[model samples]
Target: MGFWIYMLAMDLLIPLIMTGFGWYFSGRAPRKINPVFGYRTAMSMKNQDTWEFAHRHSGRIWKICGLVLLPVTVVPMLFVIGGDEGTVGTVGGIVCGVQLAVLIGSIFPTERALRKNFDKEGNRRKDGQG
Candidate 1:
């Protein structure tokens, strides 16, 4: 039971973090662009406009993915509640892996959106122009 609880807490950590960071990034990303934090990418760092756009786009993705993963993670753990430590750990690890994948996978769509909305120079596109 104790180990299960511990593993459950560990597994849930990623989703919680993703959600929290998502909220922060969505509402208030750093005003200035720097290498230190808040979704740094070649395209995103092009300018203030790109920086804010990437944060807002990725933030929304993280928020939704985290919310969805929360329930998906919990359900599997609930099934393993009374299981052995190995079983609990394995399940927890799997859940964490999925959450991690979702977290990383979020970057793609944001980059795509950035490309779709803004040019390589970070200038916003006009109408259908790429």
Candidate 2:
């Protein structure tokens, strides 16, 4: 139980911080651009050429953090569930729950947050990129 909490603290905190950083450093604040469009705009190929100004690296960084956290998240969960159910379950559940919050809430939000404030470029918005 105690061990699970400790592991959860380590694995979950990374993603939580990553997501927080993503929001903290939001590019331009897309008050006008729609959410979906914002994502597309940031990830498109047209946004090339040393343009680390917008949500490119930040988005990628947040995503990378999430990706890394995805695997790390399993370790604590296994420890929690594999241990004794009576006592360990309670602690494990709590810790896993914390990581779950970051996984569910922050994960997608961070992705969306990446494109929260940016506009499309050029006449053709579609660059065949998904």
Candidate 3:
């Protein structure tokens, strides 16, 4: 039980971090563009506009995914409360894997949006120009 609880806590880390950062980024992403931090990508780094757009776009996705994953993560653990260590560990691992998939997967939509809104030169497209 103790180990199960510990695993639960550890498994919760990703969702919590995602949610927290999502909330922060959605509202107040870093003000400046730099190579060191924030959502860095070729398209997103094209300019300040792309940088801000990527953050807000990705942040919104992360916030929603994190909120949905919270219950998804917790419900499975409820079933394994008294299970063996191996069972608990396996379930926990699967949940964390999903979280990681979601975290990495968010990049797609953000990149797509960037491509749609901005050209290779980072210039915002006019309506229907995409």
Candidate 4:
């Protein structure tokens, strides 16, 4: 019981934290170069324009992913709370894995958006300049 509760709390808390981070950072990400904050991919860091675009895009992705994950993480808890320890653990592990997958999955769309909006030289594209 205690273990299940702990797992449930952790599953809920992590995604909530991710949502908060995404919301806060998306709105407040710095324009200047910094080592510790914002999205720092090679394409994203190509310039100030790319950096800002990447963070803004990725921020939205993170927020959406976290939002989607919050309820998903809870579903397993409701179903497995009264089950045996092994079932609880398995469900908890699977939920956590899904959350991790969501986190990783966000990168793809963000990078794709960045590429769609900007060129390799980090210049914003006009209408159909791909």
Given candidate 1, what's the lDDT at residue 61?
Answer: 88
Question: C-alpha displacement of 102 in model 3, angstroms?
Answer: 0.9
Q: Write the per-residue lDDT of candidate 3 for residues 29-121, one digit (tens) a residue.
A: 688988897989999888888889889998899899889889989999999999999999999999999999999999998888888899899
C-alpha TM-score for every candidate: 0.95, 0.35, 0.95, 0.90
Please give the lDDT score for candidate 4: 0.83
Clash count, candidate 4:
0
In model 2, what lDDT does residue 15 have?
71
Give Cα distance to truth, residue 57, candidate 3, Å: 0.5
Candidate 1 lDDT tens digits, 22-68? 89899877999999989999999999999999999899988888889
Candidate 2: minimum summed lDDT over ten consecutive residues — where?
Answer: 121-130
Q: Taking the tens digit of each residue's C-alpha lDDT, what string does model 4 give over 39-105? A: 8888888888788778777777778878988889997689987889899989999999998888888
Judge candidate 1 against the unseen true structure and give its global Cα lDDT, from 0 to 1. 0.90
Overall lDDT per candidate, in order of appearance: 0.90, 0.50, 0.90, 0.83
How many clashes (backbone N, Cα, C below 3 Å) per candidate?
0, 1, 0, 0
Q: What is the lDDT of residue 30 in candidate 2?
A: 37
Q: Which stretches of candidate 3 lie over 4 Å from their true place?
A: none
Q: What clash pairs does model 3 have?
A: none
The C-alpha RMSD of each candidate to the native structure, in angstroms, is 1.1, 10.5, 1.1, 1.6
